[model samples]
Target: MDVCVCTPQEWDTIRSQRADALDASLESLGAQPVPPVFHTTAAPDPSPFGIQNDSDSERDPDDIPIFGEQLHAPSQSPTDTLRNITRSVRLNVNGVPRDRSTWKTLRDFVDERTIEDVLDTIESDRNALDDILARTSDYPESLSNTIAAIEGSVPAENTLPSMQDIFQAQGIASTDMASHLESLAAHFEQMSTALEHHEAGETFVHEDLHDWGTTWAEMNRDTEELPAILSEMEERLVSIDAAQWVPVLSQSRELSNVNRHSTKLVATKRTAQQNLDAHRRILDDLDELGEIMSEMLERQQAVEDEAREHVALLHHHIVTIEDLQHRFTSYQYAYSKLLLELARRRQYRDASDRIVNGMIAQLNAMTEGTFSSPQSQASTHEPEHGQYLPEDVCLFVQNAPTRWNVVPHNQELEVLPEIDSDLLDDARLRVGTGVAALGASQSL
Candidate 1:
């Protein structure tokens, strides 16, 4: 059975028709009639209402046909009888209209057409919605396959050497990927929808979309008209008991603030933890480096001490050579003086030999004895082969002491005290003095 309900536009049309008929009846009876209006005129709703103009016909808004159009009274279409029209002319003028304030939000007020329209919209975008839904349909299979592939291709146990958390990597789950794809598809669909709506010449006003929430909340009811509906709503909002909700709202706000701060603090804690870990690792490396440097320093110190000892030995050798050179110079001077004295003594010995020879010749003439001087006999004097023979005197004469000192630059010069001849033994010197005295006496 086909059933339909009248819309507000159809109701208004019926009311206007009734008012006109009532006005006509009162004029014929010669009585003043109420103005032919039930409510103030307003712009008509644009939504279709399944009714057309019947120019010469009269209808009533409150009159309803139940079950079907078969019950409608087709015989009273015109009502040409003046008696019947006059009898019904006394209508209530101050009758209260239907309460339409709940028409938008009440569940019983919405018509079937609005539900059909919503269903139609859903049907219109079915393909796009299907495409979005299809993305996640394979989630279970895909996730299982991904896990299987990972298990097959990659070992679960870490194969690489341990990094000790020195590095990090990020991974996405199959479900996450599917969800991301779904979101992207939804975004594309929304963009396509918006573009299509824009191209269809629809205005971008909030009023066009705001009516859906009202239409959706409503169920079944005739829309009502009121002179001060908007004003009553304003008063309701202004007179709300705000004192009852202030603490709840404040607590919610405080909770939100605490949550925001807690999130920030958690992030700070994570960042600080990362910093501490990195610093600890760096500190470990630095400590190890410090230990290595300390060991190197100790080894270097040992080498330096050894080098200093070697330098000291070399310096001592250099000083001993210099002292030996000074003594050698003094011996050379003494040896030259000894050679001079030897030459002088040899000349004196020759003169003494001549005098002794003369005395011997005279004694031999007197006593007729054979006497010969020592020089007239064979000498057989072997050459001196001892330390007295200085090594290569010609080498000292030919070469000037070009590098007598072998001291290096920056090396300290060692000073030795002057040698005191009194420190020598007198016995070693007296033999040399006695030999010289005997030679002197023989010469005299």
Candidate 2:
């Protein structure tokens, strides 16, 4: 194989083609473009032979702009960037939704942050500002001295690495970078001075030592007056001392003696009271007994009168019954004759017998006695025989009908001989004795 040495024109054309190919590859892979370098050979041609290429100079990978590759250049001013950063940071801090007022607060905060950023940029690149002045030959000796003094004031460990260190490591230097740093520093210094003036103006509103003296004077007046008021109170208190209270002390002693004797007298009175109470109770009991006796006498008299009326009414009932039975007998005789007449007439034979039988049954019930009928075995009696019947018969009569002959039975009833006045007195005496015995038993 024969090697062909390439001309300068061909070399330049090959380098441009290689660069275009690399740019296309970077675009396809979403990667940054590689730095410029020399190529040793061209790509393969359409002919049978193809060539492998190597590089003459190794690409400096660090020289690529990372900021340009990854981040888009937003169409925003510095003010807008500062505002956005403030809004985002405020949302992160408070975790609350923001409105227009919140945005205004954020705007103020953004201004503060922008000024701080300017200050930080100025502070970090202070040496760069001096370097710019030095290159231009514009920095005075005193300014240089002041910078050196400030730098010396910072401890060695606390000092930040300069941009020159980065440039030296990369074998590159920025000619305009220092001038940019100087412009930023001057603006930052102006902002700082304005902020200091604003703070100083606000500070003047605070109270001075003379105002403190006024408060101290008021406190002293309160202290002095309070003691004099206390002294006057002390004099008033002195008027109530033991010497001035001798009469009151004597009165208190007399009252105490009187109270003591009154307590003893009350105890003696209680003893006498117990004896008097016993006598009064005896009199009360006698009075109650007398009242009971009087009530009993009145009840006895009423019972006696009621008994006399009841006896007379009973006698009248007996006579009335006797008269009714006599009438019943007469009716029976007439009915018997009528029955015989009907038997002779051959009229109502069974019906007349039934009615006669019912009448006989009713008569037996009323008289509470027995008399046999030949045909039906039904019996009846006269009123004279009714008294000889059982006591249940009397009870039956008492309940069965309301009137013997148009009279209330309960009204006609007499008090029994057992509840007579003489008997009532005897019972009352026995009841009083029992009650007294019960009281005594309970006391025991």
Query: How would you encode candidate 1's per-residue C-alpha lDDT over 177-208 as one tens digit per residue?
Result: 34544654654565566568889998755664
Give me the runs in candidate 2 sitting further than 4 Å from their true place. Answer: 1-252, 257-268, 271-285, 288-299, 329-333, 345-444
Error of 2 at 377 (Å): 66
Q: Evaluated with TM-score, which candidate comes out highest?
A: 1
- Whole-model Cα lDDT per candidate? 0.36, 0.37
Model 1: lDDT to the true structure: 0.36
How do the predictions measure up, each by TM-score?
A: 0.20, 0.17
lDDT of 2 by residue, 53-170 (tens): 2243654432221111112333335344334434444443232233322221101111224333533543334334333324424324544664565455443332333435533432
**TM-score attained by model 2:** 0.17
